[model samples]
Target: MGDVSITVLDGDTLRSLHVSLREDTVSLTGAQVLDLAESEASRSLLGLSLPQHLKSSALRRMNIDGVDDDVDFRRKELSPEEASRKLNEYLSAIADELKDNPLVASNLDGSALRMLLEDEDDFAMIAENLFTDLDTEDKGMISKREIRNAVVNMGVEMGVPPLEEFPLINDILKKHGAEEEGELGQSQFAELLQPILQEVADALAKNHFAVIHNIKIVNGSELKKVLANEKKLNDVIAKIKQEKDNGKSGHKSTEIIKDFLEKNGKELGLPPSEANEAVILLYDAVFADIDSGKGASEEEDEFRKLVTEILEKFAEQLEANPIYCDLDG
Candidate 1:
C-alpha cells in the first residue's frame, strides 16, 4: 500500500483518512508504519514504482531475512510480530520484479529515479544498456563507458528528446579527474557515481533535493556517527512512550533518529555497498511512494503529518514484538 489514499469510514461519513504509498513495497516491520500498508486503496497504488525500485527492495529483504527478522525462515518466511506479518505477499511481489536485475540493483540510487521521473524513455534505454553489461562475456561486469553511455543515453532513450540538466553527471566525472567530454571507461567511474546516484535517489524518493554540495563516500568508519545519535532517538522514543504524546510527527521523529551509522556507516557493521540503503530504508519507512515529482514539495512540508500513523504503529511494534518479550527475560 505504498502511498495509497486510504479513506476510513464508519457509516455515511468519514471517520479517519490515510494516505501512504511507496515507489516500492516497504519492509513491513522496518519502522512503525504497518497501518500505512493496510489501507483500502493500497493495492491500487502498486503499479507506479520502476522495476529498479522493485528489484532492490526484494534483494534488501532477502538479504535481511534471517538477521532482520526475529526467526530464520531461510528465504521462506519469518515469525514477525503482528505488524511484520501484515502484508508479506504484497511486499514480496514488488521485490520479485527485480530478481533478474541484480547488477542493476547494485547500481541503484535515488538519482536514477530522479532521471527516470524526468524522462521515462531515457531511463528505460539506460536500463537496457546497463543490463546488457550483465550478460556480456566479461563475467557480468559493466564497463564505465557502458555506464556512461547508459546515463547519457538517459538523455534520450528513444533517440528523440532534448537532454535535460545533467550537471550532476559533469560534476561526477570532474570529481574523478575524468574529463567532461571523456567517456567513463573504468569500473572506478561506476564506483565514483555511487553517491551522486544515491543522492539523486534520495531526492527522488523523498521529493526534496538535499543538495549534494560534495559527495562524502561512506567508508568503513562512518557508522559511529550515525549511531551516536541513536541514543538520542532511543531516549526520545522512551520519552514518547512514557507520555504517549511526545507530539513529534513520525517524519520529524525519524529525522531525529540519528542513525548511529552515519559516521561509520560503512565501518560499524555497515557496508559501503549498502550505505545508501539507510536512506532508502528511512524513506521507505517514511515515504517512497512518489517516484515522480507529484506532491513532493507539499509532502516535504507535511512529511511528519504523512508519517503520523506509521509512528504510532512503531510504538505498538516496540511494545508488542516478541523481541521485547525475549528481552524482558
Candidate 2:
C-alpha cells in the first residue's frame, strides 16, 4: 500500500524515519544509516515489511565502502551529509543485486487470518473449502498431515506463510499432533485447525512474516514502448513474417500470428497465454475478431498492418485488465 517506514534506535529512544534518499534529512550515525538503508531497500525492492532477519541478511551481503564487518560498522560515526551519501550507495547496490531476481513481497501481520478465525460463519466456510480441497478422494476425510497443505494453500493472501519460510508452522503442527498419522472428518479437522490457527495468529501478532511472491505484473507499458519504436515494430513484423513462412501449411495467417504472440508475448508486455483463464479469454477474443480466412498470399504491408492491429488490440486489453504471472513458472 504505502511506503514502509523504518524504526532506528536514536540514542536512548527509538525513532521512526520514512527513509528516502531524495527527501529525508539524515541525522543518524553510519551504523544507523546502514540499518535504515537495509530496511528501506528490503521494503522497496523485496516488498518486505518489518523484515527483521531479512534486513540483517541483506545487510551482510551489501558491500558498503569503508565498512568491512559488522563490528567495524557498528562503531563508525558519520555526519548527516556523509550518512545520506552512504545510504544512497548501499541502496543502489541492493537494487543492482535484486534487479534480475525481482520479487513481489507483502507484510502479513495476521490480522486478516485472526479476523477469519473470530468469525464463525467465515471460518466455517473456509474450513469447508479446505476440507473439500484436501479430501481429493471424495471420502469426506483427510489426513492430519494435510492440514499443513491447507495452511500453505491459504498462503500469504490469507496471512499464512509457506511452511518452509516459517518453520514455526511445523512446530505448531507437531504440538497439535497434526504430524501424527490420522484421518479427520470435517468437524474434527476444524476442531484441530482452530487451535493451530490461533497459535499462528498469536505468533504473527508478535512478529510478522514478509511473504515474497515469485510473480511479475504485465500492464502494457512495454507494449507501448514497442509500438512507439519504429525499429522494434519493424523487427516484430519481420519475425512474424518469418514465423508465417515457416509455420505449418494451410494454417491461417491469423493463427500463425496468434501462435507467435503466445510464444513470444512476454517481451511485448503481454502475459503468457496460459497465465490464467482471463488471459486465455483475451487471446481467444482478440483472435476471434480477426479474419481467419486471411492467408500468406497477403502482401507484406497488409500483414504488417494486421500484426500491428493485433498488437494494439492486445495492448488495449492488457491496459484494461493487467495480468499477474508466475515468473518462476
For all candidates in order, the CA lDDT equals 0.35, 0.72
Summarize candidate 2's per-residue lDDT along 1-329 as a digit string, tens digits.
Answer: 11222222111111132345444554666678877776665554334553344345345556433336766766677767777767776665444334322345666667867788888988998989999999999998899899888888887767787788789888998999987998999999999998998898888778877765666657676788899899999999899888777745567778788888999987777887888888898898777777665545468888898899888988787777766677667
TM-score of each: 0.19, 0.60
Candidate 1, poorest ten consecutive residues by summed lDDT: 1-10
How displaced is residue 253 in candidate 2, in Å?
A: 5.2
* The candidate that achieves the highest TM-score relative to the unseen native structure: 2
Error of 2 at 83 (Å): 7.9
Clashes of 2: 0
Cα shift from native, residue 25, model 2 (Å): 14
